[model samples]
Target: MNDVMWKRSLALFAVALLLVLGGCGQLTNSSSTASTGTTSNRKVQTTGNYSTTGYNSVVTEGHYKTSAARGVAADYANNALDVKGMETGLMQLSQDVFSPNKYTFQEGQYISAANVKNWLGRKSKSNATGLNPEANGSTDPDKRVPEYLGTMVEQDYMTGSGSKLSLGGISIALGMNAVDYYQKEQYGATFQTKVNKDKQLQEGKTMAQEIVDRLRAKNNVGNVPIFVTIYSLAEQDSLVSGSFIAKATATGKTIDKWDSVDQQSGVLPTVNNQKPINSADATAFNNFKTQVQNFFPNLSGVTASVHYLDGALTQMTVNIQTQFYGQTEIMSFTNYVASVANKLLPGNAPIQIIVSSVNTTQALITRNSGEKEFTTNVLQNY
Candidate 1:
């Protein structure tokens, strides 16, 4: 594969990695009924790698879409972290209903790069299916209006095993801008179009319904369960990520009921020295942060993004920034951080600790749910 194709494959894998959970092969009632007019007596089987939860995934090896990966960079927030979070976060949410054990995962096939560009554009005489409001020929930075519907991500789930798998369900994530930042001219003053949480949620829901109507027109979508979620993208400069506000399942061509998602994300060690969300996990992370920073005082900073689902800690990603460049020093620090993480951090949820210098990643340590120790890797310079 070429570089572009390789990167796209990696992006899809990253999204799938987040959906990994612990179990195998039993399809949920909703999932079993999600078939796209395909019938088979074959029981669901694992044709791919197993998740941390021991659940085997039905792998779709050659079904990646190159445009979907580019969409993350072009349509989502400018920050790489935000882009990664939004895509992976959507898959994590989809796993709640379409378990990885039962559904074969694949990158979105229906929406293309041109389709995303058109839908994000303002509604105009030439663009009839635009999801954003018309520009109205405003020149002022504030009056021109920033786009609210930033990006749309689609994840397709399939049921059954082997070559006979069919569409089990589909997930659509709307990445909306909570704060739309724009400049009047090149290298000029930048202004923000702030939309409150309430308004963002409302606007996202409206867009979700519209998107579902458009998808229903597609021949492949059929009557399979379509899960539509609304995510509020964080500011471009934020170290933390945005959260999913609400999600609903569209059984027919339209969504009938919407349910609020109690999902949230926060920066570790408390930003502005504010109180932490879950005291136990917060305390553990703070202690781990202090120990690692103290061990290597040259460390620039240690921060984390903790994710919660239904008020319970589900995942934590820690980023350790340092200035040291020596190979031995990084190796020692990576080991020490791994030990501290294994000792201090909560073990009930998945944790990923990354050690970096300047902008390059130096080492990585990860521990899956229910695991006592973390697996560490120190990257080698070429």
Candidate 2:
């Protein structure tokens, strides 16, 4: 099936599943608390930057057990607090982000009731109570497998007081598939919905408030600023703010307030003055897109967005959608786009390229400094 047809079919199937499994109870998981330790033995240290030691300890102590959860937690702990005009000297308070990596069936896939039961049985061996809490003596056909993910916390250290004030942020991950299911059931909504419902915002606020209460009680810190981030894991795993659902900030004893996740933007470090995308840059990018279309006639779409900091281009994200014949085709197309983007963009800034087909998603982070990170995941086979 074509991409458009595949998406429609998935939506229909989700609606059917919801109808068949209506009135199911929400999934929940037990929280396991791990103590936030001192940084005396930490190998890395920076005076004003976010605490690398604290982040590493969170991972090392098994606060975040899954790779996906840890990846999300680390991204927030490292980059969320250092926005362009934000204050410095904030330390990640705790690394425990959240619980429950809920199971989600990807698009273009279906499971028989027997198979789901078998899968749950296998998952139970790893966790004492099984991954799906609803599976205990329940015959719900649409049960969810919720496993503990991880957590991340950031705080500000008070100078000359030897006390760390809470001034950073915390992020929790809600499995994307679970979120998709809930959104459909709650509002019959699609992913294209620009604004989240008030109910969703309230849920985020409650989560943030709970985190603040726990942190304050644990560290005896006074009222300080905190940003609570909620990440929804999609096919492409990245901490780009756009991929998140809600980002809320709170201070003192006040309740956490939610902001528009759709209006979020990101800035790269090292650039001093932020600048808009100039006509020349846009023309160059358009020319490159034309070249890509000519070379890869099967490509469905190509687009790019530039990120600036202090009047200098610091990063650009290029997204491409096409049907790939195989892994080789996907890699070749991605590398070619990376090369084109590198030449089109100025300076030593990084470029993130995302290529998506019907059942596969691949991403590449490339820079003029010769640094690269690539990841590819095939959700299904044609």
Which candidate number has the best TM-score? Answer: 1
C-alpha local distance difference test of each model = 0.71, 0.37
Tens-digit lDDT track for model 2 on 1-382?
3545434433332232233223221111223232343334432211221111122112223322222323333342222312211111111111222111211101101122232233223235554422223324422224432221112323322211112211133322221111322232556543322223443444445545654565455443455444455443322222232234455555665554555443223322112354424555556666777888888988756655454433455445555667666767776776776666656655455554556654445444344323443333333334
Enumerate clash totals for all models, in the order shown.
4, 17
lDDT by residue (tens digit), candidate 1, 1-382? 3445333333332333333210112112232322222235434333333233332344333322233544543555644455656666777788777887677776677777777878877788899888888875666645665678876777778776554777888888888888877766799887878877787787888888898888888887788889999888877765566788889999887789988888878766665568787889999987987888777888666767788989888788777767788999999999999888888998789887767755467887888777778999898965
The lDDT of model 1 is: 0.71
Task: In angstroms, give how far residue 81 of model 2 lies from its true place.
Answer: 21
TM-score for predicted model 2 compared with the true structure:
0.37
Q: Give TM per candidate.
A: 0.80, 0.37
Clashing pairs in 1: 21-53, 22-53, 23-53, 23-55
Over 4 Å off in model 2, which ranges?
Answer: 1-196, 220-224, 230-246, 256-258, 264-286, 293-350, 354-382
Compare the candidates by lDDT and give the number of the best one. 1
